[model samples]
Target: MKEVRFFYAPEATITEELPQDEATHAIRVLRLQSGDEIFFMDGKGAFHRAEITLVTNKKCMYRIVETMQQEPTWRGHIHLAIAPTKMMDRVEWMVEKATEIGFDEISFLNCRFSERTKIRTDRIEKIVVSAVKQSHKAWKPIVNEMLDFKNFICQPREGRKFICHCYEEVSKEDFFSLISSVSQEESLHESDDITVLVGPEGDFSIDEVRMALDNGYESVTLGKSRLRTETAGLQAVSMSNLARRI
Candidate 1:
C-alpha cells in the first residue's frame, strides 16, 4: 500500500494547475509524474483528490477526482495571542507546533516588556502552511500581523477571553480547570471560541495585565511551573484543543 500525501493549494478547485511552490515540490522534489494520484487542501475546510494530467518543466496540472468538505477535529475557534521572544526561531517553532495541534488563529502582541516588537507574518504563514500539510489539517490557521498590546486588548472579540500572566498581585484562575468546568456545564453542541494571551519572557507588565483585565479579559495561569514564552503559547493551544476535542 502507498501512503497518501497532501499539498497546500489555496485555489485547488479554481485552478487546474498547482501553485508554483507546490508544483516545484511535486514535480522536482517529489518526482511525481503524469497519471499519479495526489491530494490537495484548499486551506478552507476542503480536500481534493486529484490525478495528475500533465507535468512540465515548471507546472503540474491535475484533474479533480473527488472533493471532500471536512469537519474540524476540535470545536470552536482556538486563538493564541502572544508576545514574541528576542529569538525568532522560538516563535516560529511555536507557530508550527500550534498549527499541528490544530488551532484556528494566532496573533503576535507588542507588549510593554516585549523583547521583539517586530514580526514577519509572511514567514510565519509559510510555517503554518507547511504544518497544515504535514498534519493533514483541512483548515489553515490565520496569522495576524503584530498589534500593540493595548490596541489588541481593546479590539472587540466574541466568546471567552483570557490573559496568562505570572502575577501574584492579581487573582488568577487555573486555565485547564476553568475549561474543564465549562465543558461539563455545557453540551458538546455548544461551541465557545476562546482567545488566550501570553506575554514575553519577562511576562506582561503589571500595567498591561491590568489593562487587559479592564477590557474584560480574565487572568489565568497555565500551571505551577514557570514556562518560557514559546512553551506557554504551545500549552495554551494544546489545552484548548484537548478541551474542545470532538
Candidate 2:
C-alpha cells in the first residue's frame, strides 16, 4: 500500500498550488507526479484529499477530490504560556511533544526571572507545523509572540486561568486534581478554555507570582518534584490534555 502524505497548506481549499516550501518538497523531494494522490490540511479543522494535476519545476498544483472536517481530539482549548529556556532546543522539544499530545495554543512569556528574554518564533512555528503533520492533527496550534509577564497576566482572558509555581509562601492546588474536579462538574462545557503559565528555570519571582494571583490567576502545582523549564511546560500541557480526557 502506498503511504499517505499530508502537507500543510493554510489555504489549501482556496489555492490549487501548494505553498512555495511545500511545493518544493512535493516536486523535488517526493518527486510527486501528475495524478499522484496527496492530502492537505488547512490547519483549521479540515483536510483536503487531492490528486496532483500538474507538476512543474517550481509548482505543484492539485485538484481537490474530497474535503473532510475533523473533530478535535480533546475538548476545550489548552493554552500554555511559558518563559523560553536559555537553550532553545529544549523549548523546541517541548513544543513538538506538546503538539503531538494535542493542544490549542502556545505563547512565550518574558518573566521577571527569565533566562532568555527573546525567542525566534519563526523557528518555533516551523517546528510546530512539522509536528502537526507528524501527529496528523487537524487543527494547528496558534503561536503567539512573547509577551511581558505583567502584560500577559493583565490581559483579559476567558475560562479558567492558572499559574504553576513553587513558592512555599503561596498556597497551591495540584494542577491535575483541580482540572479533574472541574471536569466532573455539571457546568463543565466542551468549549471551556484553560490557560496555564509556566515560569523559567529560575522560576517566577515572588513579586511576579503575587501579581498573577492578584489578576484572577489561581496558583497550581504540577506535583512535588521540581522540573526544568521545558519539562514543566510540557507537563502542564500533558496534565491539561489528560483532564480533558477524563
Candidate 3:
C-alpha cells in the first residue's frame, strides 16, 4: 500500500484541482503523479479520498474516490484562552501540540503581567494547519487574535468556565475534581463546551482574578507546582480534553 499523503483543501469538492499551496507540495515535494492516491480534509470533519488525475508544475488535480465524515473526538468544545509567553517558539509549540491533542479553539489573552501583549494569529494559524495535517485530524482548530483579559472574560460563553491561577490569598479547587463533579452533573448531555483561562508567568493579579470570578469564571488549580504561561496553557488543554472523556 502506498503512503497516503494528506492535503488541506478547505473548499475541496468531488472533482476539483488542489489549491496552489497543496499543489506545490504535491507536485514538487511529494512528486505525486497522475493516478496516485491522496486524501483531502476540509478541516470541518470531512475527508475526501481522491486519485490524482493531473500533475503539472503549478497544478495537481484529483477526482474524489470516496468521502468520509468523522465525528468529534470528544463531546463539547475545548476552548483555551491563554497569555502568550515572551518566547514565540513556546507559544508555537503549545499550539502545535494542542492541535494534535484535539481542541476546538484557542485565544490569546493580554493580562496584567503578560510578557507579550500582541499576537500574530496568522502565523500561529499556519501552525495549526500543519499540525492538523500531520496528525490526520478531521477538524482544524481556530486561533484568534489576542484580546484584553476584560474583553475575553466578559464575552458570553456557553457551558462550563474556569480560570487557573496561583495566588495564596485566592481560594481555589483542583481542576480534575471540578471536572469530575461537573461531568457527573451534566452526564445526560454529550458534554458542555469548556473554556479555561490560563494566566502569564506572574499570574493574574488578585484584582483580575476577582473580576473573572465576578464574571462567572471559577478559579481552579492545575497542580501543586507552578507552571510557565505556555505550559499552563497546554496543561489546561490536556485537563479539559480529559474531562470530557470521563
Q: Which one is best on lDDT?
A: 1
Q: Which 10 residues in a row give candidate 3 its minimum summed lDDT?
A: 182-191
Ranking by lDDT: 1, 2, 3
**Candidate number achieving the greatest TM-score relative to the actual structure:** 2
In angstroms, how far off is 168's CA in candidate 2? Answer: 0.4
Q: Encode model 3's per-residue lDDT on 1-246: one tens digit a residue.
A: 136568999888844899898899988888999999999899999889989998877999889889999878777889999999989999999999999888899999999999999988999989999999988889999889899999999999988889999887899999878876764545776347889999988888988999999999998999997788888888888877887753
Q: List the residue pairs that clash in candidate 3.
A: none
Pairs clashing in candidate 1? none
**What's the residue-level lDDT of 158 in candidate 2?**
79
Candidate 1, 131: how far from true, in Å? 0.9
Top-down TM-score ranking: 2, 1, 3
List TM-score per model, in order: 0.95, 0.96, 0.93
With candidate 2 superimposed using the best TM-score fit, by how many Å does residue 16's alpha carbon deviate from the native?
Answer: 1.3
**Candidate 2 lDDT tens digits, 1-246:** 136678999989888999999999998999999999999889999989999999989999999999999977787889999999999999999999999999999999998889999999999999999998888888999999999999999998877899999999999999998877763455455446799999999999999999999999999999998899899999999989988853
Return the lDDT, model 2, position 244.
84
What is the TM-score of candidate 2? 0.96
Off by over 4 Å in 1: 183-191
